[model samples]
Target: MAGIYIHIPFCKQACHYCDFHFSTSLKYKDELLHALVKEIKLQKSYLDNETVETIYFGGGTPSVLEADAISLLINTITELHTVSSDAEITLEANPDDLDDAKVKALRRTDVNRFSIGIQSFFDEDLLWMNRAHRSRHAEASVKRVQDAGFENITADLIYGYPLLTDTKWKQNLDKIFELSIPHISSYSMTVEPQTALAAFINKKKQQPMNDQQSAEQFTVLMDAMADHGFDHYEISNFCKPGHYSKHNSNYWQGVKYLGIGPSAHSYNSEARQWNIANNAKYIQSIESGKLPAETETLTEENRLNEYIMTSIRTMWGLDLDKLNSIAKASASPLLIAAGQYFDSGWIKQQDNVLYLTPTGKLYADNIAAGLFF
Candidate 1:
């Protein structure tokens, strides 16, 4: 099955650590919406007639869109393609945007899931990250989503910020568990090169991220999730039984999806495309009846590397037999070389599936590289 991703490309304000394509100004909102609708029509056949099982409204801040605008966009897509009856329609919402009325309006639409960006439950961490919402709003957003009867929900949390001590980090996860959030995507904070946080660290105004603390916190995350009965399905994702995110799971499984709007990426089995990150350029190009995106044709080696990268990050480890079948010539030598890591306890094989052990996960990248052609 295929999926659809629509990027909103607008935020109330920029976060210090965010490098996503978005405009602080909403002056071009009307024009952008018009161009987006046109884009939906233009890319109608990109999915090759596969029924869309997930529709994800992501980036900038999808919750910032007016309810009418959201409804209009969903309606346009439904008219253009055959969406599945039980599609996992998700909207990435910010805490500040989830007022009672807005939440109610969203529930009435085709959107069946909510993914809230609540980076932390502490005010100090929120301030440090330059988030638009306070810690209180962070807690309230998920509550409102559940209160609205939306059982399919996901929330994002950040760990390992300089300001987040182990005690505070524990509290953050505890609070989420107390609230009974079904799905969580927790990431260790990193300094993206051009973000304000990176600049601050470069100037010595703010401390650089501590790799040791980050690793330690990640261990804490694993233990806590295990205690809570949350399945560690992917590297950074945890979910209750039967509540895994279908959209992201499809992505990991190499499902084809059409990405609409600026800075979005799409992939079919053989090729991938990424839209221009600039809003003005995207709109202008689409208006001129030209799609402004670069395409990459996947070579055999590229596909192999991608499979290794994604497969090892999940509970479902890499299938050696499947690999041998798909990329026959490259498999034997790689498997022979990987035996060292396997013998050293960094990698394990069971039922012909190869995966990282807990120690191996710390160096997943390096291990994957060693096994790569």
Candidate 2:
């Protein structure tokens, strides 16, 4: 019914296109961990005693920690919240960190899921992305985890960059299918401001991302996943039946969850809050028994827009009945707004549910934004 997301704010190196909060240096690592434990205890009531069905260790690179350290954090969560016995405890890791020894060590802990960051299967692309791991590490890491009896796994792949030819993209997809990894999370390359990729584009050092190329590759990705019998459960995620990431699915479904660590965000239906991004400041505030965070109370309009945005991205589509529940008759205006998309054959309705057609997915953001209150 609920989940917990813990952000481990340290990475071995920085990726060119990454904009997530992380530190290349592990200077505040030990102190940060201690403060994280304190924050967990302090925010125990955020979810109002709901059972935690997922505990995800995301960002900067959760696999950077030792097995014992990871176990300690899980143990802390168990003490504070009622975690489901079969809960999906996931660790987001880089391929280079998942050597045989590391995978074996992780198997001894509570982690039953692995979210591997295997951006590409080519050394040139890896170098271009400034990723810490190469093609060898990318393939070997997933196999090592599977070899260690970890079947609940998902690997990330990136496409739509200048160097990713159609053949190369297929090759990457083939490698994953060959590996028989049950779940995949793929994304198109985007140039976010303040990132190295953005800087490169600004200086004409690297080519900017191509929207047309991304659209073509995404179409390819969808077809390939469908051919392999993987469900396109959400826009960016695909999985064999029943292999979805419970934590992320919960997010799209609007379930309550507490976010721990710097730059983490939490939601409990009516309001949302996120901790400060500064490690030292977050640690200091937690140590002083104060939450270093900002909170937002959701208005009726805010809730409706959020629901439309998240729901439309999933296979479940947006429920007009549910939308009306948020604000009476809200779906009428939305349907009126969506008339153009309907005319374009981009959306269809059945039994009060509005589902996006395949073509509609290409402009999902635009469609969702247009229908927003």
Candidate 3:
């Protein structure tokens, strides 16, 4: 099954660490929505008539839009494409935008899942991240969504920032557990170049991220999640059994998906494409009856490397038989490269499947790169 992702490119305010494509102004909001619907229609055949298993509304903040606006897009998609009956329709929202009224409005739509960006429940951390939501808003949003009868909820948390002390980090984990949210997507603070965080660090206005702190916090997260009975299904994502993000899981498993919106990426096994990052350009291109995107056809080597990189990060690890089907020569070189890691007790092999050990997960990227063809 395939998936569809709609990127809402507007935000009420910019987070200091965010580098995603978005505009703070809603001047072209209506026009952008029209263009998004038009793009969905234009790219309807991208998935080759596969029934859409997931429809994700990700963005600068999808909840920034009115519920009717969201419903319009979903309606447009369902009409133009073949969607599954029980499709996992998820909307990524910021805590501040999810008041009771908004939750009630969303309940009328087909969105069964809500991925709230409650980065931190501490006012200090929230302010430090320049988030628009306060701690109260985060707590209230979770309760409101649950009370609204939406059980498939996931809350995002940020750790390893300068302001997040070890005690505070644990408190954040404990708070999520207390709330009993089924899924948790946690990320370490990284200073991307050209972001406000990076600029602040360059000017000495903010401290740079510490790798040691991030590693330590990640360890704490894993232990806590284990004790709490959450499955560390993928790096940076943990969920209770059966609550893994179907959209993201499809992506990691190499299932084809179409991404609609500025700076969004799409894959269909053979090629990958990404839309232009500029909102005006995207709108203009769509208005002119053209797609504002670039495409790259995946070579065998590219596909093999991608599979190795993505699958290695998941709990299932890499499937050797599948890799062999794609590229027969890849397995030997990969196993040879993985030898050092295996000897070091960082990786284990069983029944031709490779998985990362607990310690090896800390350096997952590096190990994956080493095994690349």
lDDT by residue for model 1 over 91-147, one digit each (tens)? 999999999999999988988998999989988889899999998898888888889
What is candidate 2's lDDT per residue for 184-291, written digit by digit as tens?
999989889999999999999988889999999999999999999999988899999999999999999999999999999999999999999999999999999999
Task: Flag regions of model 1 displaced more than 4 Å.
Answer: none
User: For residues 1-373, could you state the per-residue lDDT of candidate 3 as single tens digits?
Assistant: 9999999999988899999999999988999999999999999899999999999999989999999999999999999888999999999999889988999999999999999999998998888888999999999999999999999999999999999999999999999999989999999898888899999999999988999999999999999999999999998999999999999999999999999999999999999999999999999999999999999999999999999999999999998888877767557778889999999998999898999998999999999999999
TM-score versus the correct structure, for each prediction: 0.97, 0.99, 0.99
Question: Residue 156 CA error for candidate 3 (Å)?
Answer: 0.6
Provide C-alpha RMSD values for all models, in order.
1.2, 0.8, 0.8
| Candidate 3 off by > 4 Å | none
Query: Weakest 10 consecutive residues, lDDT, candidate 3?
Result: 324-333
Name the lDDT value of residue 74 in candidate 1. Answer: 92
lDDT of 1 at 271: 90
**Local distance difference test values of all predictions, in order:** 0.90, 0.93, 0.94
Badly placed stretches (over 4 Å) of model 2 are none
Q: Candidate 1, 351: how far from true, in Å?
A: 1.5
